[model samples]
Target: MTDHTTTPPFDAADHLPDELIERIRARAARHDAENTFPHDDLDDLRSAGYLGILVPQDRGGAGLGVAEAAILQQRLAGASPATALAVNMHLVWTGVAKVLRDRGIDDLAFVQEGAAAGEVFAFGISEAGNDLVLFGSDTDAAPLPDGGYAFTGTKIFTSLSPAWTHLGLHGLDTSSPDGPRLVYAFVPRSAESEGTIEVRDDWDTLGMRATQSRTTVLSGAVAPADRVVRFVPPGPNPDPLVFGIFSVFEVLLASVYTGIARRALDVAVATAGARTSKKTGKTYAQDPDIRWHIADMALAYDALPPQIASLAADVDALADHGARWFSLLAGLKHRATATAKRVVDDAMLVAGGSSYFTRSELSRLYRDVLAGAFHPSDPESAHATLASAWLGPIES
Candidate 1:
């Protein structure tokens, strides 16, 4: 571990160094094939301080916002979606910590230390049964004899569990028996004294295989009262900006999907220019149909980023209006995710059968892009949220 403290500062927009890009590109296949975490590539991110991009500056982090983080994720995913997906959990949880700080959590020092040290973190929100609710989880916490309640339940798709140092556990508080109370606890990943935590190696998926999004079971996991953040009451309440900030996660996800599509288009265009067809002895690029397909790919690739950028700018500007801002945020996510899926599908068609080959980079991009639409802030859920907002309380 060489000292990265004194390294010359680099711009995030330089599109990641060639060495790092080569490293991620080289391991993309192995990580996907073995369904293993991309530790080596993440090491590269740690060394470059890319992992701390979203950490606050006061906490020794780069203090970049969603915009810069989105750019970084897109560039990384352009080369390796699995590696990008694996690291995204940390960024999201760090954002949550920031939000907590705004609510007076006062634990900025610890967060900064962890970010500076490149500590890994995971968001444990999704559950097997409550997947439709997006933010809902099956785990619950209750008041214990000493005040802190025991957290119990299983969480599905706990990404980056293998390398995480902090677990952002989301669960309902059973102590409030009248209604479910949402609570988020920042627990040490190593705190399972009884060894009740179990990670299932059952995440066999079509894309982003290196994410290591397996299941984790926790039985009577004791959590301290202080470790648990304040409970969120059930209802359409809170500062609307809270939900708006969450929508930024979807934008980051969409950026990655768009980057994958861009990469696929790049490969298709370059290949089409050189490879000659058998019948005409002419390059595929000269064929009228192939050229038209290439044009369509180029058009799509050029169009999506501006839309994402505009949406992000809108969210940033609406920092005051809570409900309206949240609605726009959800709408942006709905559009971006849907468009990303369409763009990648077009990329695959342009690349032809070669894109389907196991070794083809385009094949991996296609798979990962498709996987993007199924993430938590998915297009369908975003649309439903938007519709609910439009219809008022009656729709729910």
Candidate 2:
């Protein structure tokens, strides 16, 4: 993860020190066991200015790009996947703002300023069954007299639910004179929005429990005119907002899962060296089959960081890939998640039956890795994108 040949000239250790990583790692199991959000971890990250890493340095942030952020996320995930995943939601907004600003689109400058000012932003894009993803929304965006819009819809998997100050969301504005438009906006989570935003405390899950990415009920939550960012058509387009979100989300998600694979490999290596075979009276590391398995894990893992770094660097450099961007990003996400799952499974086998226990770290990783498959650009959608890219769109 430390190798950053294709990334920016930044060091992950400076922002996420070894001590801080270990501290977060120590708290992960407890938070997981209790099914509680990692409040302390968030506090520590905020104090370290990790929340504003993507904001411009002049604006009081680390001023890093997606490449650097990807490296930092990998390090963080190596310690605590849930914390890294939850924090990804906040980073997504700042990353999007950065993406927009890099291309001279300053509409989201407020997002950068907000992040630099210690305001936590939560991603409120996910819905229960609106599979169109960035292309469509089930949420209703009612136009207001003062040039604002009121959003009413339930956003599922709203990460950082309890601590977010701003909720970045999108809704469909069918009332517009020019047909349905997807309105991307930000709403505050304060006393004024008491009845509008309801966060259901039902995030208890099989793993990654520290995230607490609960369901959010947006009952006419208002986004002031100044905060409303985009008004794109209700379908696929080359809008910077959509590209920024998809690119950043896919890269960061890949980084987290890659980190999980790295951790699993390390654990497997250690287990192989320490555990002795009852039949041969030798360490498992000496067995040819175990060596091959570890090697396979290493091979699968070694390819991820470079891909993540290259794509992220391309994004920061604003390289145009046309329609190919979706296919490339979708493939990266699919490979990262699938490879991480395989590595974790192999690691569990190497660690033997002891890893099956709930107390084992590999067991936790086993469950956490399963969640990677369920994220956006899921296996089905990813395959579709790739097929369309290589074989051309299916004939009507």
Candidate 3:
């Protein structure tokens, strides 16, 4: 992996502020200990316009692209993976909203405005028995008498559900029982009508404790039909497949994992410098073996970004064929997620028993980075889909 550490003239946007970084460092420990969401750090992101970095300028946003967004998320994940995981959903939803706007669905202006203003938005996908399909939510929406729909089902792992103004829900339309009619809706979290949508504060996990990835149960929750922004046709939409939407998620998630790895490496290096081995009177870092582990950790962390960047560039070029792009995207996400898990796992090993203690930052990094493996675009499904594409019968 290339070492850009000595490279000068790096773009400032590619890095985060020292204060924010410090806050993330401090908050990572505090949030993990308290097992609560990182509200303070989120406020910093909002004030810095980082939350709306990907929103279009017309929608009162900075209009940044995926590359920039990925960079911001990577840096933030290094500080706190849970916060990064929780917040990145907003950008994903904003991107979806932008697509809706381009398709002439202007009724979602409120959501766009709220996103631009830094309002948190949770993604309601992933069900208990869905077998780790992130987008394969079990929630169902049935057409109502007033041209709207009544949504009812339980959505699990809804990151950022505890404090968010909006929710991007993906469900099937039961009214048309013949085939899968995927529907997307933007529900206002604060609305009285949405009271039926209960947020379950039961997101106790091995990592990403601050994500508030609790269960959200929607029981006959009526959402305006106008709020239905997009209805994805059953089977495959080439855009989601080709544009690498799933792959992008994987890549983005990998970025977060890399960040965690990076932080773990940093803490390890710092600790090694000061920590003396119990048997030998020498510093633990002085050992050649310890140095090699650090080198390997650095290599893994450095190798990930370029791979993701290359895939993203490919994705950007395939904007015309959404299906091909989405398929490729899925592949990318799969690779990155698995790679990230390995990198962080190695980081934890390198850190040794020090990482096991609550006082060590590596402890939290170890926990937070593991979540990437199980994030929406699971590695197993990605591989299965890729395998199907390779071995399945070719379309006539």
Candidate ranking (TM-score, best to worst): 2, 1, 3
Among all windows of ten consecutive residues in candidate 3, which has the lowest summed lDDT? 1-10
**Model 1, residue 45: what's the lDDT?**
86
TM-scores of all candidate predictions against the true structure: 0.87, 0.98, 0.87
Tens-place lDDT per residue, model 3, 96-173, is: 555445545455576678888878777776788887343454788887776677789988888887787777777788
Ten residues in sequence with the least summed lDDT for candidate 1: 1-10
Q: Name the 10 consecutive residues with the lowest summed lDDT in model 2.
A: 1-10
State the lDDT of candidate 1 residue by residue for 257-279, as single tens digits: 76676667677777888788899
The sequence of per-residue lDDT tens digits that candidate 2 reaches over residues 1-396 is 344334458667789988899999899889989999999999999889999999999888999989999988988998999999999989999999999999999898888888888899999999999899899999999989988899999999999998999999999999988899999999998886523788999998988888899999988899989988999998888899999999999999999999999889988999999999999999999999999999999899989999999999999999999999999999999999999999999999889999999898999999999999989999999999999999998999
The true-versus-predicted C-alpha distance at residue 392 of model 2, in Å, is 1.2
Model 1 deviation from native, Cα RMSD in Å: 4.7
lDDT of 2: 0.92
RMSD of 3: 3.6
With candidate 3 superimposed using the best TM-score fit, by how many Å does residue 395's alpha carbon deviate from the native? 13
* TM-score for candidate 3, residues paired by index: 0.87
lDDT of 2 at 144: 90
Off by over 4 Å in 2: 1-8
